[model samples]
Target: MLGRLDHVALAVPDLDAACERYRSALGARLSPPKDLPDHGVRVVFVELENTRVELLEPLGTGSPIARFLEANPAGGMHHICYEVADLAAARDRLVGEGARILGDGEPKIGAAGKPVLFVNPKDFAGTLIELEEA
Candidate 1:
């Protein structure tokens, strides 16, 4: 059902400062930042051997990340992304098994130009689940 732990997304107030923190203090180099209009957020990917870390910050007040930050003052892990072989199939299985899809239908182009889908935590035990087909 899942391939690997693709990435862990962190919701931050400032993307640049966060990237700098990861790079300078943590000795990490992010690939590049990308703006995702659909999600209304900018993201930077910290590439690793088998996985990556995604830094996500809201681009506007209406952005989902912004809303999440508002509720969670100390924004931390936003979601855990899992690599999937077939996104459509995985989505169907989850829905059939009673998991609610946070986003409609198929996945859309998200941060870093990757296809991404969000599943409601209600069905996933309070964890925002992200599925990315590799």
Candidate 2:
């Protein structure tokens, strides 16, 4: 099962601008943005009350965020990641429920180089769900 709301990820067109906007809106400090070359995106973490909001901006044309923005027209909430006690078990449950995983298996390094897994929206009610080990 899910542990807590680990973070909420947003797809943005400009990482720096989003960081400034988040800082101004939340009055919270910004964690240095990290470039995730593998995913072709950069991210900044804004620490909130108990969870951090992650701003994601594509680094290049091949970035998934870029494609997402193109398809959606407006960059917005990308996904909701929940910290789980056992990611493997949670994945198994999802699979058992007829969910299709976006990746091969298990969590892998994603934005911020954090271990994360993407579950297909088709199986999760049109919302891309991310599962991370607690």
Question: Could you tell me every candidate's TM-score relative to the true structure?
Answer: 0.88, 0.88
Candidate 1 lDDT trough over 10 residues, lowest sum: 103-112
lDDT of 1 at 38: 72
lDDT of 2 by residue, 1-134 (tens): 78898888899887888777777886878889888777888888888778888888888668888988898766899999988888778878888988877868767876545677888987777888888887
Q: Tell me model 2's lDDT, rounded to 2 decimals.
A: 0.82
- Deviation (Å) of 71 in candidate 2: 1.9
Question: What lDDT score belongs to each candidate, Candidate 1 first?
Answer: 0.85, 0.82
Model 2: per-residue Cα lDDT at residue 86: 81
lDDT of 1 by residue, 26-113 (tens): 8997977888777788989998877888888998558989998898766789999898998889989988998898857678766546
Candidate 2: minimum summed lDDT over ten consecutive residues — where?
105-114
**Distance (Å) between predicted and true CA of 118, model 1?**
1.4
| Candidate 1: C-alpha lDDT | 0.85
Each model's Cα RMSD: 1.8, 1.8
